[model samples]
Each structure stands twice: as structure tokens, then as C-alpha cells.
Target: MEPGSFWTALIWAIVPMLLLLAAIWWVDRYEKEPLRLLGLALVFGGVLAPAITYALDRAFDIATSLSSQQIVPEPSLGVGTPLVEEVVRGLAILAVFLLVRFEIDDLLDGLVYGGIVGLGFGAAANFVGIWNTPSLGSDTDSSLYTSLISQLNHVFYGAVIGLALAAVRRREFPILLGAIWWVDRYEKEPLRLLGLALLFGGLLAPAIAYALDRAFDIATSLSSQQIVPEPSLGIGTPLVEEVVRGLAILAVFLLVRFEIDDLLDGLVYGGIVGLGFGAAANFVGIWNTPSL
Candidate 1:
């Protein structure tokens, strides 16, 4: 370990873990859980459970080595390591279950918590693995990639264990599974309409706004440089931009009226319009920006 490697390693390790946890938290969006409890679970799985697993694994490894004639033992992927790590993580979940039985209201809840706990463990393990890698250089890139893959593996295995432990109501499984299937089964919007909406919003809207800005430049004391007494680009900008955007939506509505069945349908169309406009505008802005 280098002198200041501790802080560097801690930062790299904790950041990715935090991001992964955030994603898991979002997945449990329908029924948000207590952040404090989840944080604690993270700590238990990352810190406490890993420590317990390490001790048990080392002890078992030593015992097995003494009994068996295996000359070199592979600690990293040894059967003992997975068995011990999972059991320890499962115990952490069990402790939470005993104290907060109500929190596990359904199988979904169990799956989320299980995945979270696993993520915590993965975070710590990833930190250690990455922290120990060769100093930041080309070689470390592969190490970082492997670290992410392993962490995800841990979360997946943890979720599987969680599902196993949860007492699921069989009747609800079909409904829950059907909802996912339904979302996938929905019809997709045409790409041609999407492209047209984007072009209108991005190119046509900007061009119209520029023209209007120049045309409305009323100057009391006109000079070549100060011909257009600096207009409030803010107020008129949004109004012009929105109207142009609305025109795009109106075109879609007229052409594809059948698509707008309800509020959700309208929102879907509106979202497409907004997304296309924003994407094109941003792309152009980035392309035209002086910094670039």
C-alpha cells in the first residue's frame, strides 16, 4: 500500500457502489423503503458480513488444507468462499427480517432487500479488489471492468437467494409477470414520425426563432451595431420555441390521431416530441459551442 493510496482507493470503491445502490433503489420504486434501513443493510452486507465471511472462509480453508492433500488452494474461487459468503450475507438478511418483519411485506420487497444487501457486499469487495490493483494506468482498466462484472454477479446471486427465502403468493405471480409482459408487448411508435418531429423542433424551430428575433428588432436610435436594441431573448425565446414545438405535436396529432387514445397516449406523443427537440437542440448547441 502506498502512502495516500487509502483515500484514492476509498473514493474509487465507494463511488461506483453508491451509483449501483441508487439504481437498485430506483428499481424498488413502486414501494420505496426506508433509506436509513437500506443504508444499514448496506453497511452490514459490505462491512460486517464480509468480515464474518472472511474469517469463516479462512478457518474452513485451513481446516480443509490440513485434512486434504491439496497442495495449492485457490482462495478466490474456492467452493468454500461462495458458500461462506452467501451464508453470512443471508444471515445479515435474517437479522433484518427478525427485527423488521413488516418491511418484507411481499416477495418483491424481499428480492429488493436481498439484492441491496448483496450490492453492499459487492461494494466492499470491489473496493478491496480495485484498491489493490496496480496504480492507475492501462493495466487498471481491465481490473476496473472485472470489478464491475463481479459486483453485478454478487447482486444477481443475492437477488436469487432473496427470492428463495421470500414466501410468495402464487396467485399474484401471474399478474406480476403479466404486467412485465404487457409492457414489452405494447406497439412501438413509427420511426419516420419521430424523425420528422425531431427535425421540426431542432432545425425548423431554431431557424424560425432566429428570423423572428431579427425581424422584431425595433430600434429607436438605429445604428449598424445597435440596430436591434438587445431583445429579451428569455421571454420571447420560450414562447416561440414552445409554439413551434406545439406545431410539431399538432402535425403528429392530425396525422396519427388514432394513436392518441387517452392521457397516457398523449403524454407518450408529447414525450417523443420533447425528446426529439431537446436532443437536436443540444446536439447543435454542443456542435456550435466555442469551447468545443
Candidate 2:
């Protein structure tokens, strides 16, 4: 590759990853973690977690083939894909949690970890997507644009999911402990509502982005029909996704009234899960595409 092209590809890879890390940092404004651990989490979540997931996926495939359940073969989507993938990703989170339990001081920690995992996943996926595009030689501009947009979208999705997991974990713990009993009786109700808000906000970010993109396309088409054409902003979907993600973080604040520790834990955990999924998806995308 030419030096210019290599630099462009490297930038394309690093920028989205950095933006994701920054967003995760912003969400955990309450309890700031050491930069070293954060960087460590990012490296592991981005690099190692994906490799582990890939290995597990292959192992599962072999296991399924070896099993002799001829009378009742497992449905591909129901029994095979979702179950195996979820387990593989969940194990990645579990491994990190075990090794760095001390680092995960609060719900927000969960969000951070989840975000790191998602970032790693998104980076890997974007690299593959960019590398596989046949238009790279003929339509470099369009291909680069597409890669950037996809990377941002993936990062936003991962962050939202990370936030949700963190908040839920935080709430579950206080309930398990005797902390809630000492607080006002009405506190728990509000916390539960907050958790729900986070869940919905996180899950809906991608759908909202999809809707906005469709709306933008329609608007652009209508504009072209008139004498004068309106310019495309390209900001609608990302803005909406960010709003939803921010709301999730806000929900975490309102729902978890205990010490900041639980919040950090939830934040990091959610981030790890999102990261793992993003990485797995990236790997799949790479494998499916034509090599550079």
C-alpha cells in the first residue's frame, strides 16, 4: 500500500476507536478511573477478546458437528447462533471481571469495560469492511466515507449497550445487599424505572439511527424533485444516537443512589459485552469479504 493510503487506513481505524473511548470516559464522569487500567481494558477488549471469541466460535462449530442428536437437530438461529455467540461473549466479560475485579469499583466500571470490548470489536470490523471493499481502488472517497459512517454507528451502538448493562448490574447489587432496606421505601421504585429507561435507550439507539437514515433518504429524494436541491446534513442519525446514549447514562445516575462504586461496575460490564459483540461481528465481516 502507498504511504498515504496506509496512513488513511490507520487514521480510519484509530479515530473511531478514540472517539468511542472518549464517549465511555464521558459516561463515567463521576468516578474517573486510572488511565493505565482504562488503556489496558481497551487493549484487551479490542485485541484479545475478539481472538478469544473467534476461537470459541470455531470450537462451537466443531462441537455441534460432533454431537449426535439426529432425532432433533438444533435450529440454526434459535439453538445455534444466538446461544453460542452470547455464551462466547459472556465468557469474555467473565474472564476480565475475574482478573480485574478490584479495578471494577462501581456500575460505571461495567460500562467502561463493555465500551472497551465494543470498541475493539468495532475497530476490527471496520478494518475488515474497508479492506474488503472492491471500490477501494476506483471510488476511494465513497469507500472511506462509508467506512467512517459504519465505524461511528458501531461505536455508538456498543456504548449504549454498555451503559445499560452497567446500570442493571448496579441496581441488582443494592437490592441483593441490605442497602435498600435502610433507604426510603420509594427509592427502589424510582431506581427500577431508571433501569428500564437505560434498557430502552440503549437498545433503541441503532433503530433510531436506521429510522433517521431512511428519513434523510426520503428527504433528499423529495428535494431533488424540486427546482433547487437541499443539502444533506448527514448529522441526523448520529445526533439521535448520541441523544439516546446520553439518556442511558442519565438513567444510570438517577437509578443508582448508592455509592459511585456500583455504577462504575455496571458501566464497565455493559461496555465489555458490547465490545465483544462488535469484535465478533467485525471478524465475521472480514471473513465474508474478499481480501485486499
Candidate 3:
């Protein structure tokens, strides 16, 4: 690699991630975390955690390569990387959480802090990836795109774990929500409203929909006295679920029209409603899971 290539590749790698980190900072609606602590989290992710991950990765690579057995099912370098990365990164999150537990006012706070660290980690990882990319001859566009997308995957993983940790600590809600929550660009939506939307989708919509389906089943049973597939369980589910979520979105739209200025803003609400509905569905699928 050329002497200047490292700096160039590193710049290409970290800039986009820095912009994302900036966006996360912007969306942190309620309270801004301490900068010093945030920086520490960044260092832990970009420097400390990655260093540990690299060491572990190398060892794991050697061990897995030497083993003839398919120890990990997928058994590639990638299979165990998430476990190694998340553990080190989770510790980074834990340090920040411990140092500034009082600052974490809400779940979003956890999202922001954890996201920052994740972005930092992603940037470093991307730099390594880009640095190692076999020169695709003159054009670096492909390498840059691959690195950015891969960086985003890491960011999502890190953010989700962070969000889950926050949910666990507060015991407020489940992490059934998707990483799309971060897509609210400005992330101005209140977490409580989002939670409410999820509840509406999960509980009320399902209840009404299920009732209507049961009525349909009884009516069909009495008249036809026959059925294939028992009316296909929740036959009106999609329509009813959409309508219920649409109502929730409309209610939220009316309530917070100011926060949702554009289509993307509206989408954030819609997405949350969808996620809430999904979370509830998953919980109903597994009744014993209290976390759900």
C-alpha cells in the first residue's frame, strides 16, 4: 500500500460514518450526552474495541482454519465475527453506560450513545476493509460503496444491541423494533409515542381483527357447515392491521404534525407502527417471553 493510500482510504472510510454520527447527535431529542464521555465511547469503539476484536479475530481465524470439522455451522471468518465484535463493543457500551448512567434520560439516549460508539467502530472497521480491498484497478467507487454498506450493517447491529440494553435497564419496552428507528433522519419522534403506536398495533388492532375473524368463522361454520383450513386464521388480518396502524398514524400525525414535516417524517411514524404491530405479533407467538 502506498504511504498516502492509508490516509486517503481512512478518510474515505470515516467521513461518511462521521456524518451519520452527526445525524444521530442531531436526533437525540431530549438531552445531549456529555461530549467527553461520548468521545471516550468513540475511542473505545474505533481504537480499543477494534484492537481487541482484531486480535481475537486473528486467533479465531487460525483456529477455525486448522480445524477440519464444521465447528460453527457457517465456519467462515464472518460467522464468529459478530459474537466477538458485539462482546467487545458491548463492553464499550457498558463503560459509557456505567460512567454516565444518570445522563441516560431515555431509550433514545442509549441509542445515541451506543450509535456513536458503533459508528466509530464501523469507521475503523471500514477503514480496515477499504485498506485491505484489492485495488480494483483505478476506480475506488466499488470499494467505497461496499465499505459504506458494510459499515451500516455494523452500525445497525451496534445500535440494536444498545437499544436492547437500554430497554433491559429501564424495563420499559422490548427491542422488537427495527433499526429503521434511526432513519427518522432527525429522529424527532418521541419514544413514548412510538411505544404507544406499537401497543395500538399489537393489542387493539389484533383484538378487533381477531374478533371479526372469529365472527366470520362462526357465520361460515353455521351456514356452510364445512371449511378448508378453518377460514385461514385471521383472514382479515392484513386489512384490519393496516387500518388500525393507519388510524394510529393519523392520530399521531394530528398530534405531532409539527414534528413530522415531510414524507420521511411521516414514514418514521408508519414504520414504528408497523414495527409495534410486529413486536406484538412476535410476543403473542411466544407468550412466555416477558421481554417481548
* Highest TM-score against the true fold, candidate: 3
Q: Could you give candidate 2's per-residue lDDT for residues 1-292 as a string of tens digits?
A: 3112545556767887787677777877888877876666666656665565556545654222112112222343245543443344445555655666677666557767766766666675555434433332332343354455555654544444444445445554343222322222333334454345435444443344435545764221112222222234333423444454555445554555352344334444334333333343344435544543
By TM-score rank, best first, the candidates go 3, 2, 1
Q: Where does model 1 exceed 4 Å of error? A: 1-4, 60-78, 133-141, 168-292
Which runs of model 2 end up more than 4 angstroms from their true locations?
1-7, 54-87, 136-292
The alpha-carbon deviation from the true structure for residue 286 of candidate 1, after best TM-score superposition, in angstroms, is 50
> Could you estimate the TM-score for every candidate?
0.49, 0.49, 0.55
TM-score of 3: 0.55
Error of 2 at 142 (Å): 5.7
The clash count for each model shown is 0, 42, 0
Q: How does each model score on lDDT?
A: 0.58, 0.48, 0.62
TM-score of 1: 0.49
- lDDT (Cα, tens digit) per residue for candidate 1, span 124-165: 776665554455333234334435556776786676556544
